[model samples]
Target: MRILLALLYVSLVGAPGGSSLPANDSFRNTIQSILNIGQITLFHIKKLRTKLPAAPQMEFSTPSIDGLTSISRDLQILDNELQNPVTDLLSQIQADVSSMEGRVRLFALTMGCPVQARPRGHPWASLFPDSHFYLILEKVQRYLDTIFLNKDKLKVC
Candidate 1:
């Protein structure tokens, strides 16, 4: 399950589109991709929840699952908002992203996984072909951090 989620994170947010669109257009496109990836992550998290046994090892089973479900529902609302083109939604979208980041981090800590905290404000131009990849890259890094930190914890569970 960790491998699957990692692969999904990499594929969904790994590559940045290098189109020569205007700055405004590129920002919008990147935001759209971020939103789409957010939805995908929520769905996969749901699937992961289903696979967890009714009786679990970890102490965080109830609250963690509840939090994930709540986030999934919130993402659905954000999805509806995304259908209409608007920059005003960016703040809300970013807030949702932040919430997911914290939840994922807590999930990792609960699972006892080691998280890889990437240095903040790293240059995307070196890792990605496009500079506009920051949003998704940040998401990917956060997810990766959670996974890297908690793999051992998962084994114990």
Candidate 2:
């Protein structure tokens, strides 16, 4: 009876074809590792934003304004690539980056913050008491817009 019980235990513990249980555990561990990496990346991004020098007002120019137009065009191209019937990972990453670039450009423009440079710190942050954090909030909103808009474009590769 003890021998029969031991055999049963081995069969239940082992994978089909006699693959080691450790191998399956390793696979699960790897998946968890990847998830942990993603979480760390997000945390690092938040930390970096906190450490950034205050955003300055941007100066608009024919060339700078034109850059934004070019950026928008790039976004359209990325979007088109993502919408292709045969979708892949690289196309998705490009779409995400393009979307992010567009939103950042747009937010900077709308906030009356110079895309070039206004001053060392955000003037609007201090001058507009009622809207003290409006510029920063706008930037965050733009980031969210980019992320949600291009989420489907994310590529594992």
What lDDT score belongs to each candidate, Candidate 1 first?
0.40, 0.41
Per-residue CA lDDT of candidate 2, range 1-157, in tens? 9999999988887656566577667645643442343344345445544755555563322211123334334334333333333323233333444445455445435434445321232122244532323233333334334434443322111
Tens-place lDDT digits, model 1, residues 1-157? 9999999888777545433356547545533443455565545444544654342222211112223333333333323332323233234444545554455444444545555452244222334222222233333334434433432322332
How many clashes would you count in candidate 2? 6
Clashing pairs in 2: 57-114, 58-113, 58-114, 58-115, 59-114, 92-153
Off by over 4 Å in 2: 1-20, 53-157
Score residue 123 of candidate 1 by CA lDDT: 29
Q: Give TM per candidate.
A: 0.26, 0.26
